[model samples]
Structures are given as structure tokens and as C-alpha cells.
Target: LHGKKINNHTANEAINHGFALVTEERRSTGIYAYLVIGFNSLISNIRNYKNKVGLLDNSRMKSDTQWVIDSMRVKTPGHRTQIGSLSGGNQQKVIIGRWLLTQPEILMPGSYTPLRA
Candidate 1:
């Protein structure tokens, strides 16, 4: 990673270098099935949404959630809806969008087959 030798303890260091990996089991490991869509959209990047006072910024979360929904083309009634209710494809989209917010230089997705070449 950027010429630095990465070790098992340096996982965060790898991530800091713009590395992202999406899990193969999206339903079982990628998403919180009972949580709302907005939660799923922001959970991966939640640390960035903290304000100066150590509180979450709701408006910012909402905006970013909307971005995930629109940019990922995830079809859901609203952010408050439980993510488990969505189709499997849509859940994967949310996972991808979650990682995209980190602006990773390298994205490795697991167990994927495109419908078209």
C-alpha cells in the first residue's frame, strides 16, 4: 500500500490508502436487515458525519443517503424503510454505495456476475 508493507494489524492503514472490500454475503454480513435504509447507507461512513460537538449531523446524513439512493439507483419507498425489504440486487447496490462514499481508489467486490458483458 503506497509502498508501505501492510501487516495484519494495519487494516485501517490499508483502508486509509483508499482500499475498500465488499463482502460476498451481502444479506448475512453486508447489511443490517432490520435497520432502516438510511442507517445502512451511512453506517459504513458514520464517523465522518460527526459534528464539532460530537453529535451526528442529521441533515448531512439525509443528503448522503439520498445520494446513495439516487446514484446507486436503489428503488425504495424511503430512507426509513427496512433494508431487508429490498430485493437482493438493491441490497448489493446499497453496499456498493456505502463504500463509494469513502472515495476508495481500489474497490474489490466479492461474488459478482454482471448481467451484461
Candidate 2:
């Protein structure tokens, strides 16, 4: 009821759907790669755009996003680096960054973490 063409819970519902555990195939191909991008960038980007408060508050968003990638020990020379070129562990971090930025009430990495520890 927010708008004639709008649904307030639409974005929230979408993000919830995105919170899943997926297993990547042993070999990489364009189709699998597209699935990765869909799960990582699309959901998070939509949530952020819909939730922005101000440019100032956005400071934490940027930092926290980078932090998730760093905490996962991704070899991004810069935070803005494209996630596609990274090794598998690093690529997982990018997806993690997407989820962490949204600060979802529940997060399930679902065995994607390749680290031994």
C-alpha cells in the first residue's frame, strides 16, 4: 500500500530469498558466474539504495563492507576491486561483503567458507 506500483516488503523478501547456501561447481563457466553475481551484487545493491539515510551515514556502510572482505583475507589491492578475478576464497568474501552490508537479522554462510579454521 505504499504506492500504486510499489510494495514495501518486496525488497526485504528478495533479500531473504538471497540468503542461501550454494555450492559452486568445480569448473567455472559463464552461467555459473552469472549465478554468483546475481546472489552477491544484485540483492545487496537493491537493499542499500532502498535504505540509504544520508551520505554521512554511508561512511559506515563502505567501511563495514571492506571489513568483511578483509576479515576473510581477500587479496583485494583496493576495496573496489572486481570480485571475479579473485581466488575462490576471496570470491566468497565478496559475497559475504554483500550480506554483511545489509546487516541482516540472520546470516548463513552455508559452508562456503573454505578456510580450515
Candidate 3:
């Protein structure tokens, strides 16, 4: 389904154990919110925050999220700009960065993989 669109999203599927699957399509959905929310999710899950942070800290989240986006070279007008505002390549980078923040030993196989095997 590369370069195509699906009317429905199945990203909510369940997985056994602690595993992460980043699909190309999932790469573009809610691209704007993905960075903001995904950043908070990843940080909260991996750090000592442990849900103790208050909701008002979302500004902090947005700021930090923007920093990650900029560091990853995800071109946009600014950090506050919505994901839908970015080009296809930039949006893809955002999703990639979200996954990379996990620091998993990734195995992206086949032709879609960025690096040749």
C-alpha cells in the first residue's frame, strides 16, 4: 500500500510482550499530533516521570517534542506547526524519530529499508 491510502487504521492492534512495529502508513497518520503525543508517551514510558507530571506540562512536552523534531531534521515551519503542514518526507522522518527514541535494535528489511543489506 505504498503511496496509497487506507480508509481505516489498524494501528490499535495488540502485540505480545514489549514490541514495537512501525509501518510506513502509520508513519503518516496524525503526523502533527503523533510527534507531540508520541514524544510524551515515549518519555513517560521510558523515564522516571511515571505519570506524576501534570496535564499543564503539555507546553513542556510540546517544546521538548519540537526540539526532537528539529534535531531529527524533520523540516517544518516551526515546532508548533502541525504535522499536516509538512511535506511527505518530513512527516516520515517524524515517525522514524518517534520510533528511534525507543533505541531498539531495529531490523528494517527488504526494499523499504533505508540502508542496503
Which candidate wins on TM-score? Answer: 1
By lDDT, the candidates rank as 1, 2, 3
Best by lDDT: 1
RMSD of each: 2.1, 7.7, 9.1
Model 3 C-alpha RMSD to native: 9.1
* Model 1 Cα RMSD, 1 decimal: 2.1
* Candidate 3, pairs of clashing residues: 32-83
Candidate 2 local lDDT, 2-65, one digit each (tens): 2334333675564554443333542252113434333343345444443545333345545655
**Residues 26-61, candidate 1, lDDT per residue (tens digit)?**
888899999998999988678899999999999999
Q: Give the C-alpha lDDT of model 1.
A: 0.86
Ranked by lDDT, the better of candidates 2 and 3 is 2
- Model 2 regions more than 4 Å off: 1-11, 14-46, 49-58, 109-113
Candidate 1 matches the true fold with a TM-score of: 0.89
TM-score for each predicted model, relative to the true structure: 0.89, 0.51, 0.51
Steric clashes per prediction:
0, 0, 1
TM-score of 2: 0.51
Which wins on lDDT, candidate 1 or candidate 3? Answer: 1
